[model samples]
Structures are given as structure tokens and as C-alpha cells.
Target: MDLRFRDPQTRIGNLADEPILVVCPRCSRRATVTPERLTCAGCALVRVRSAPNYSVWNGPVDPFFREPLWLRADCCGGHTLWAFHERHLDLLERFIAAKLRERGLGDDPGLTLVARLPAWITAAKHRDEVLRTIAKLRATLS
Candidate 1:
């Protein structure tokens, strides 16, 4: 008879083992990570994924196999805000820099920059800028 409480490691289904490309915090370079470790090509820093929330599943293997699992990376200093298909991040940074310059917030890290996401997204100009930058970034990756 098949045991209901079999060893999790020994039991086999369609275990997810995909890597996510991200930017390393220390060196600020491209890297990829699996459930095992995060490997940075630029800085040559490797770290194990001890966090349980790193790998997230959507649904059952058959039903949700088409959807990709979101892999969160934290191999860097802390929770590095880098993930796959996130070229918009670069655009967001550029936009913030421009705004800072317009407001003459020059080189001051003391003043925090906060933006309303809904407003930013709703603005046609900002949305266009983000899309354009994302396209450019994707081209570079290609």
C-alpha cells in the first residue's frame, strides 16, 4: 500500500527548479539564481537560498504549469529589488533622477523620494516613458 505520509524529498511530482535572473546588489551586475544558490557573474559571489518564501507556486502542476513561478532573490545585502522581466526598474530610476533634478534635490540622500504608484501609472507621459525605457532595456538584453 502507498503510504499517505511519505517522505517529501523521496516523493516525486513536478518539482520546480527554475532560475531567475537578477541584478547583484554589491556589484550591480546581472546574475541568476536557483533554489540552491545565487551566482553572480560580475562579483563572483554565491549564496544559498535559505528563505522559504523564495520559491512560490501558483497552483497544481498540470493546471498551472504554463505560468512561471516567481523567484525572489535575496542573496545580496538584503532584499534586493531585482527580478526577471523588470526592465521598468531602470526607467523608474531615471524618472526619479529627473524629478530630483527638477526639484533641485541635488545629491541629498537625506530627503526621501516618495511617489504615488497610482498617479505615476495613470499619467500618460510617465507611462510612455516607462514603456519606452522597458523596450530599450529589452533590446539591450536581446
Candidate 2:
């Protein structure tokens, strides 16, 4: 089966009225639905409404950290926006670790450590961590 067919490119505006199933770019999870705005079940990040065409997902990447990472994306006037949050890094790490464990994949302690930091700090320390993770996840499912 073509994975792309599983992950359809949905218009951002459609999320306002009901929950829409979407593939998470950070973790390769399926059937993640956004009931209101985009909120990841895999992470504690919350995407909040902003201007008509803009929205922001701001929160800590992990529970161990206080600083929050903010992501801004163009909504294309669809009444919604696309963004990611690294808030609750510890939670994210635990989630990922559990998934990896389930898959029989060894944990990368360094990566887990990095995931425990705020998004900004992680981006600065490892510039491509988030992007790379997203890309890798997309590739795996797609």
C-alpha cells in the first residue's frame, strides 16, 4: 500500500469544525486526530489560534524544562495553521522510548537526552534534530 495515500495532505482550515486524522511529523504515529486545533497526542504541545491566517504552537518540549519552543506556520487562509511544540520533553522522550522499545529498537540515550531540552536549545545544539526527526518519520511512513 502506498503510505502517501494514508497521509493525505489536509487543508489546515478543516480542523476547526471537527477532529481530523493526521500523521504526526515528529513521531511516526497514525490515526492522530485533531479534535479542535492541532494537538499531538504523542506530545504535550498545544497549537493555539492566532490571527486569521496564523497560529502558534508554543510549549515546553519536556516536563523537565520550563522554556517553551514556538513554531509558526502559514495557514494559507484555511482558518488553521501548522506548527510543532517540543514542550514536555521528558514526556516526549518517554513516549518515544516506549515506542522504540516496543519495536525492539535500542534507545539512543544521546537522542533522548537531547529530546529532554527545550526546543530552542535543542535546535541550537543540534540544528537539525527536529527537522530531521520529522523528515525521518515522514519517510518511514510514506
Q: Considering every candidate listed, which one attains the maximal TM-score?
A: 1
lDDT for each residue of candidate 1 in 86-141, tens digit (9 for 90 to 100): 43334344443342323223354233222222344325455454445444545545
TM-score between candidate 1 and the true structure? 0.36
lDDT, candidate 2, 74-121, per-residue tens:
222322212222222222333333313222223443333223334453
The C-alpha lDDT values of all candidates are 0.39, 0.32
Report lDDT (Cα) of residue 34, candidate 2.
Answer: 36
Quote each prediction's TM-score: 0.36, 0.23
